[model samples]
Target chain A: MRRMLKLLPIRFLSAALIYLVAGITLGTLDALGYGSFKSVHSHLLAGAFFTLVIMGSMYQLLPTIIGAELKHRSLAEFQFILANLGFISLAYSFLSNYSFLKVAGLIAFISFILFAFEIFATALSVKDFYRRSLAIWFFLAAVVYLVVGSAYALAGVLGITSFSAARHAHILTLGFVAMTNFGGLYELFPMLSLKKLHSRRLGEVHFFIANIAAIGMFLGFPERGNLFILSSLLFLAGFYLFAYNLTRTYFSKSHGPEVEMDISARFMAYALAFGVAGVTAGFTSATLGFPGSFTHVHLILTGWVGLTIVGAMYHIVPMLTWLEKYSTKVGQEGVPLIQDLYNKPLAKALFITLNTTLALFAFSSLLPALSIFAVPLAIAFLVFAVEMLLVLGR
Target chain B: METLDVRGLPHSERPQLILKKLEELGELEILVEVKPVPVITMLESKGYTCEAEQSQGVWRVKIRKKQG
Candidate 1:
């Protein structure tokens, strides 16, 4: 059961598909005059998709760190129920503005709190200061951020908090979801990139800078534009350090590979570039004091976050589950690395088309409405779906 | 009796770091053994609580009592 619960994180992340669906649905609804903004889509993606990944990663991280047995299998089962119900209620309330949504949201929070307690038990009992501890810290921090954001959203929904939409949205999206994803990268990038961690010191620095920048933006409020600017810069620096370390490590290794391991690595590399572009555009938009700066923000979430997660999915599920090992070896001489589990050429082409076009759309101001951004995104998704089926099901 | 047992210890730290951490967790009395001794012999030398006995290869030690 403990081993089984490990699969839950990825299971929850599959909820992000629901987010993409919501985006398409709410987009159509907007066309139909049901709602104007994509709030429901944003929440479903950031909250449900992101939370599920965090939960799943913990199952692997906790046992590695503490060597303690899971105290309760039922807690995860309850978590699955509460999270889906709460998110569904929240989504409905986003469209209908219903009061029961808050009740459901609160139930979800209570469920996560239980999950937190269980993981925290292992954290306290850990006998060694392992690297996996970093994973747990980020996961817990993400959960805490989730609780704070959810509580705020609940209050706002119930008319207890007044007009805190922008602030709460940033908290839920940037603080909770992004931070959690960053944690997973710290664990995975080393393994999948076929390199040792470049700078352990940077990991600590990045975490501090992230939390500090995030909190600074929160407390300073969005009205103080300069703080957000500073925070974003700090965050961009954090991202650069991460990219630099990863790239340096990738290049430092002396190995020849004609065939790419996972096309997902390209997605990660491109996502970093997109993230940089988003930051640049955001800065440019701010200095220009122009409208539609929010588009750059969404690009950061979708082009960067969305692409990174999808790319990582291409790597993680096959490797971690050892599904790659189950393949036939009759004609194969050298055992393929885990990254070799997928069809890279097709994925690489799709990811390149997907990311390049989408990134260009983010920065495209004068280019008369590239509504075709949706085309590459859908195509990329289809390609990824095929790769996933081939890699995971076989 | 004097003994030394190394199991379930971190590879990076070796016996020295483990002993340091163990020292921080409890009181350790100084008793030197020239040759490799069973864990019981070492525990007896340092007065560690012995609740059971075990052997690895040729060395053996028994923990028969709790140390306060």
Candidate 2:
């Protein structure tokens, strides 16, 4: 059981890296005047890369945070298998055969349902009221989004309902991916900074606002009605509040000697900045009746979600590797510090290059000449993938 | 016996500090704002015994060296 628990996260992370590389390659090719691979690229990155990482992290961290053992371990393993098969098939559907989407969507939907059940059961099994932190709330809500989004996608694939692809994307991206990130930051910002959250009440408010706005946007998006516009504005407000709360939390004073920020922490900080920028771009595009445009989508996916995942992997991969490889040797023999598990110089280079290139990529939407940045952007993602693999190897 | 308060220490630093202190004292108690599950897991893997209780969002953990 212990061994399985230790390796589960690593397995998911390894798969996510593979999808990340494939997704970036397709994205870069499209940017460099290759055939349109938009559907395939989005599926591999968002459906596979982001979703897999979130699953891995939740499987690893949720039990620890809730002070309970993960419920239905075997189910989680099975879900992982189905999730990969589903996503891989879904990505292939975009490239070759549309009929494959029915099987793919069904598999993905079932996998997420199992995940939701496992996570919810684990949380409910724990009775500690205080253990139900802001992160848990966000995670639970994101699970709801994941299940709903998958169902919506499946319906589209089966032609059971005429659903807007844009709506499906929003549900999954904002509702599932962004919500998970919100929860993650709530937990990680405090842990990383050695400070208690700046304001739990404010976080609660942000949660409500965000969730309500998400529903409102879902209902309003297809029609582009007043509700959609209102919801978008509300979401932007909630995001600002979230950004403010976490920033204050990260910068809050600690009791001990001040510690310098590490590469992982730096990645998170920059990712938050990108998140703010992405949402702003989204808001402007939405109000201008051009929501989900090339610029808006890239800013949100590549700039915000992509960077955040990379930053988080920096912390999670090393910590898990340390536990799996070195924990037993502690006190009996010397082991490398967790931070030393990954190459620092390469991480720094990835950070600087990825952020700069992503910004250029976003601008490239408006200025086509800047599309040349896609090659460097792809290289940065490749480096990130390699770095994570190296960390696991160590 | 010594009680180390790790209420505001960085997460990364807490395990190292506790390990250093435990090596010196052989047994130690820790006061932390959050349950240090990873630290406790690591200690147990290192052949230490840990007992923990929580009150008012604070965790008090008692660690003892492995019996020879």
Candidate 3:
């Protein structure tokens, strides 16, 4: 059981990468006009790749941050198995144009319900609620959003509500993905920099505004003009605040020796940059009623979310592997630093290739000639896989 | 009174240095400047007794060998 527990995170992370590969392949195929695998592509990217990474990271971090043992440790394994099974079924349903999507959706929804229940149970049992960190609030909110998003999706599946596809996507993207990533950065940045956060108050403000903006933007829906501009402005404010806070903290005087340029930190910064660019493009697309806004989607999905996940993996995979392997010998033996566990040059190149490819991909929407960049993106993933394997091995 | 200033050390190095110092000191009381919970937890797991307090946003933890 202990061994399984130790191996669980890596397994989930590995699954995320596999889904990422599948998503990229599907995306490339679609771009090349082979076939429009839209459902499978979107689900793999959002449902499989993004969800797996967030779940894996939260599973590893939640107990520590919340200061409580996981309420149902065994359920995590079940959730993982169900998630993969559900993804397979969902993909098959999409590809075959079959009626199995409902079953797949139900299975996936149940897995998250179990996951959310575990978090809620664990969090509620926390003995010192006052001592809870900022990250907990963000994560808890994300869980709530996940539950809500899942319910909304399930409703769509059951033909209950007139839930538009855009609204569903928004809820999942903003509520689940954006909230989780934003909240995670609050915890991750301070730890990586070995510095205190700039201001908890600002973090709270950012959280509040982000949620409000998310709700406003999604609820505005197909009614695009006034509501879209207002919601986007609010969203932009929230984004600016978070970016400012992070920059302040990063540039602040560290209490400890300055941690070197962590590859993950670079990834996070890039994600933030991409996020800003994406939002701006979205705003322009919305305001001008641009017919072709594939660039906006491309930037958000690849440059923002995808890059963020890739960056986080550089830190998370090595950290987990090191703890599992070398923690006991840390002080006793001359163990390598977490950064030393992976090939940095490869990681750096991977980061560059990923962002560059995403940029090229965004342009590919206008100029189909740019489609060739997908080849390098695939090669970059190969580099990523090799680096990750080396991290696990070394 | 033994003092170890971990203020200048990175997160990865703090605990390692703390444990190393504990080993070197061999039962003498030591004061470590660090984030209290994780350090105290780690020390307790290794059979050490600890007390911690925060002042001016800095946490100082005192560690000692658990007396039989």
lDDT of each: 0.58, 0.84, 0.76
Better of 2 and 3 by lDDT: 2
TM-score of structure candidate 3: 0.87
Interface RMSD of 2: 2.3
Worst ten-residue run, lDDT, model 2 chain A?
A1-10
For residues A1-394, what per-residue lDDT tens digits would candidate 1 score against the true structure?
2332245544554554555555555544543456675667666666666566556556544553333445565677677777778778777877786556768778777877777776766566655434434655676677777778777776776778664666787787668877776766665554444445577778778888878877766755547578877886777787777677666755555222323333555667667666666656655665575525655775777677777777677755554433213222312334444545666677667777777667655544445355456555655665565566455444
**CAPRI quality of model 1:** incorrect
**TM-score of each candidate structure, all chains considered together:** 0.72, 0.94, 0.87
CA-based DockQ, model 3: 0.31
Query: In CAPRI terms, where does candidate 2 land?
Result: acceptable
lDDT of 3 by residue, A29-124 (tens): 887789998889888888788898898888767765654556787898888998898888888888988579789888888988888987778877
Which runs in model 3 stand beyond 4 Å of their true positions? A1-5, A127-131, A290-292, A330-334, B1-8, B12-68
- For lDDT, the strongest prediction is 2
Worst 10 residues of 1 chain A by lDDT: A322-331
CAPRI-style docking class of model 3 based on DockQ: acceptable
